[model samples]
Target: MSDATSPVPAAAPVARKVTSIGLGLLAVGGALSAWAFFDEDLRTRFGFGYMVGFTFAWAIVLGSLFFVALQHATASVWSVVLRRVAEMLASPMLILAVLYIPLLLVALLHPDSTIFPWRNPTSEMAEHAVHVKGSYLNETGFLVRTALFFSIWIFFTWFFVRGSLNQDGGRRADITERLRKFSGPFIILFAFTATFASFDWLMSLEPNWFSTIYGVYVFGGITLSALAAITLALSALKRSGLIAPELIRKDHLYSLGGLLFAFTCFWGYIAFSQYMLIWYANMPEETIYYTKRLSNGWAGVTVALAFVRFVIPFLFLLSRQVKTDERKLGMISIFILFGQLFDLYWLVMPNSFGEAGPGFGIPELGPVLFFCGVLLVAYGRFVRRHPVVAMGDPHFEASRGFRLH
Candidate 1:
């Protein structure tokens, strides 16, 4: 097929302006995170730690979504039109991997008390459980696991991104085939790494608590959040006239919106299922996690998530018209994004502050801004190097013609 007929492009280079707004936000956010981290007050420090963690976690979500899109783009004929968008999203993974340095520092310097309770030798809180899981949750073990996780993420992201960029530079068909071959194994690696990463960072907050489904629940939440972020980014890019309107139609918007809705439901189901299982089993170790959340000010936050993340959006997005309308979809996207923040807050904050109460002080806001800034800096650089679309895919024709069934 000719360039016009094919969904993928040859060697078309697109110009993207250098916008430092995201970077500026990151700088201010980082300063706030640092101040919160060192503050003497536990409540204040916990709030900031939550913010910092959430900010970085959101960046990971975005990057992972990008990777998921690329998987579809390279493998599925249905995704040719949306492939470029996925590529744009995946481009930031490299930076997300690099930004792990600070988190590593946090995990290393304060292994005993910051997030992992088992790190402390004197804590009676998980004394029995800690003794059991000490082999895996210890400072030395955690460092090894974390290093392995980042190493895998960094390798896959670089390999996938570099391969796509090479295609843009007019590499031979063999290179394209090589990328397709690599994607399958890369995805498998991602699945394992993401699961382990979630367990270490979030689930381990209550080391005694264990759930096989926690990783899946987190994956669902991150996927939904990432889709919302992609929609917002695509809308913003289109507004700037960077992407061709012909390439992005109501059909595309509908597909994305539908996926968002589906995942929202999936996240809720997984969350409730985990709770139900724990509640039914009534194991003291597992029940304590929810018990803490239910008693403290955290109960109110949980109610908010039930309404904002699931119920409200679930009802609002039920309409066919809402999914296809760009303006409406964009607004809903904003809602989902905020809901995601709340969802993470609910998950991490309680572990840090218990049921004392929920608050969004500098400790919370600063890290969020800092990580957001890091994301912008990375995304900005990616855009500057490549076209917003995948011009070389053989299935571009089918992608442009994609429609809702």
Candidate 2:
């Protein structure tokens, strides 16, 4: 018998059919995206959209890794039931690393590529500050540093995920201890990579503008969106009778709700602080970012982002009962996931399409749909390769029967 009140059963592998559906979607979405790239001007827009798309996907996967790492480092019993889902979430990283190539090609081969301002210097790029940034912002350094980030991400993702999967077959206690020991320092490594990666990829889009808390802002979105995605997946698994009853407890949902609530606040705080600091300083470079976003039809997106990402989630999740209700949680999860997309659009599209405003059609939505297909297929196959629940975890029962008190 397991240690906690409920005896948890090992979860069965996900169905192969689910993986097939995901693959089908990927193929269809990929075809549409390729077709869109034929128009020269549309191709440029696609290039920007491509970066945003992968970055959106990366944020969720890396965010899950952060959650899993944090839980392991703290020896958190209640979250053990959800750990496997989080692991599966991180499984898409290798494929994501593959998707990053186009962005690199845009930076390297296309002389007219303006997705990254520093990569192709214009008259604006010819300014004194651009020259000052020459050493750190060169094409060679950008590519090399990006490679380094991927090296760290792919290697560690394999290490952490492989350790968890190995536990399923062996049920080794030492394995758990090793993961615990590794996670503490790994969290620090995650922070550094996340910060610099944001700097290199997103902030560099507008070379002159910068925010000290930009990485944290990105972190908040990643964490919140990852949790939302997990909750939605958990709900789907439950509805299909795949998850064990004991694994879906009020306390566990409540914990997720608490986290969802907590991060919602953290995101707001970080956003307000970053905006306020920049507004107070009144520096030209710092002010430019908010100015573009606040004007040009983007201001509406900014408002909607606040409401969807923070206000609605925070308000809905405040009540204890709602978190425990799976259906309600699923709705909130979808909302937050959508919010992450809106927030990224607000941050990025304004730079390229500010004059034209937020335009949506097949052109805008194509790459995003394609990447989503990739995420689903990658995640489904990963879960199919192993048990959906971490039966080897010593804390499995405690997690299954976890209570908030």
Best by lDDT: 2
Which window of ten consecutive residues has the lowest lDDT sum in model 2?
Answer: 1-10
Per-residue accuracy of model 1 over 1-405 as CA lDDT, tens digit each: 122432223211222232377768777887777676676664345443643465445444544544453554357655555555555665565566566656655554554445666677577655787778878877777778878876776666566556665666553567557767777776676677778877877788778778999888777777877778778777766666667788787888888888888988988899899989999999997898788778757777788889988998898888989988888888998898788777878777876666557766787777777766666665665566556666666555667877767
lDDT of 2 at 216: 97
Model 2 vs. true fold: TM: 0.94
**Candidate 2 per-residue lDDT over residues 1-405, each given as its tens digit:** 221222232222344445677777778768767876777768777777777777889989999889899999999999888788888888888888888897787645587777777765665666666778889888889888888888888887888888888888766888899999989998998898899888888888888877889999999999998998888887877776667766788888878878888998999899889989998999997898888887878788788888887888888988888888889988988988888888887777886686787776554677788888899888666655566678888888777778878
Off by over 4 Å in 1: 1-18, 42-70, 169-173
lDDT of 2: 0.81
All candidates: TM-score: 0.88, 0.94
Q: Count of backbone clashes for each model?
A: 12, 0
